[model samples]
Target: MSSGPSSYKIFDVTLKESVAMTPSLQHCVFYSEDVANMARHAPDQRIKVVLPLAGGEPPCLVDNGGWYPAWLALPAERRPPMRTYTLRNVRPAQGELDIDFVRNGDNGPASRWVNHARIGDRLQLIAPNAAFDGNGSGFEWLPPDGVRQVLLVADETALPAALSILESLSAQASPPQVQAFFEVPLCTDVQALDHYTFAKIHWLPREEQPHQPYGQSLLAALQTRLQIPDDAPRTQDEAAQGILRPELEQMWESAAPAHSAFYGWIACESSGVKALRRYLIHSCGLQRETLSLMAYWCHSR
Candidate 1:
């Protein structure tokens, strides 16, 4: 996109490296000559990617500023698979960015690309233009300014984002008391992650003898810790937005009262998150404003 004169632009990026991270995560580094124009707007900075076709990964085309509309106009066979991912790090000076991919050994487009990607393979990324002074969206880790106790729940898909939030929190003057429940595919997937001193991380592996649901461990953990009252009065703000409805395809809400001492962030499979949304608000009586619930993926069993 000619180095992007607009607030956001498409960049042709090369796969610099694809390396292993724990048992379930793949760390990929992409570089582009135009990456120097990309700027990180938030710790949970996310970018949209056009996945390469099978075999040798090739760079895909993004049609102008209205990327989606143009792509949708293309023939079904010509249309490429597109997905959103969080950035692990951005090195504007080096024209490089890192992303953590959760590898479930599935035949999904992303996992297939990761399984076959070569060092020089190419792809497309849409990211913020460094020169833009405007605000960027696609980030949801915003808690109240001085929140104390924080609850983080995620499966492998959202683990990278959860860790990114913790990293951002660590930089604060007085970090919150973070209790993070990270569920992964196996015990070996549990590894050391950088977090603040007050943060206590609990890793749940799916290797348990009796098979449990993906987010069940996190929900059970929270049930014991949080005091879910018999009822919670919803504010007009929440009621107006249908925040009480968990049947939506996915949920993404981030609005916490400034006076709140504790804030919860939950992201995982669609079904699990829907159940969590219901329990946290209706059953547990948690104020809708004190929590941010995001359904990251829907697994079709």
Candidate 2:
């Protein structure tokens, strides 16, 4: 079962409930008896959602002629709009899935729809055939066997995926040392995630640093707090004391006994992600293979 555009499947869902995770974040749960294998999806993957157009009916399936071509062939008035969203959580027994949307007014179709969505409102989604690529679902998050420490950075847009990854990691037999930093518009936006006791969660409120641009605060924090100095003493005590950056650097230094493998996952706005990726690779000396950096969205010019 190889997953690709051709392996997409349509599922009909009814909005079971909607909850406000923050002032601007809405979490919607959709249930469908038709989607029996909900648990097969990997954490951090995404699903394509198709919203009704004009007075069209809900849960309509798109022709499997490829998304763009099929969408373009439809009449202007009959075409449905679609958006990709992270599959936040899934419950196979209950046939439920969750998606979190940022309520940004009418700036985007998905936001507008989520802002007004109500229980029982129907919708359709295209999900990957997990039977084919369960390990690498639509998004990739694979840490090597020796990885014993993980760093996660994300903004509001990437929060869903980041949290899902955290949850998945926490479920392992021996979870790694997890450090996560999340940037949100307001302090009220921070949600409690007690499921993972090993993760040290840091919430950065944008409102606190009004002068700083988006992502700058996060980058600065990572550099000042997380990035280890190149000249720091090489000792296991330093590694045990939370400085895994230097430990990672020692992995390639004369084949000395390497400390725990360090891995980083970052997702944010385009410019921010690029800058962070550069800092992790060039400045922190982290191997590119151990890091995953993605620009979930770009700032509007």
Top lDDT: which candidate number?
1
Clashes of each: 0, 1
lDDT by residue for model 2 (1-301), tens: 6344355567789999999989978999999886664433567787888897766466365656555576678788777888878988878778898999988677676887898788899888877654434343566566666767788889998899988888888788999878888988898998898778888888888888897777887888887767443432233343332433433432111112133376677888777776676576666656555667777776784
Give the per-residue lDDT of model 1 (tens digit) for 54-84.
Answer: 4544646765656667677878777778787
Enumerate residue pairs that collide in model 1: none
TM-score (C-alpha, index-matched) for candidate 2: 0.81
Model 1 C-alpha RMSD vs. true structure (Å) is 3.6
Q: How many backbone clashes does candidate 1 have?
A: 0
Locate the minimum summed-lDDT window of 10 residues in model 2: 249-258
lDDT of 2: 0.73
Worst lDDT window (10 residues) for model 1? 227-236
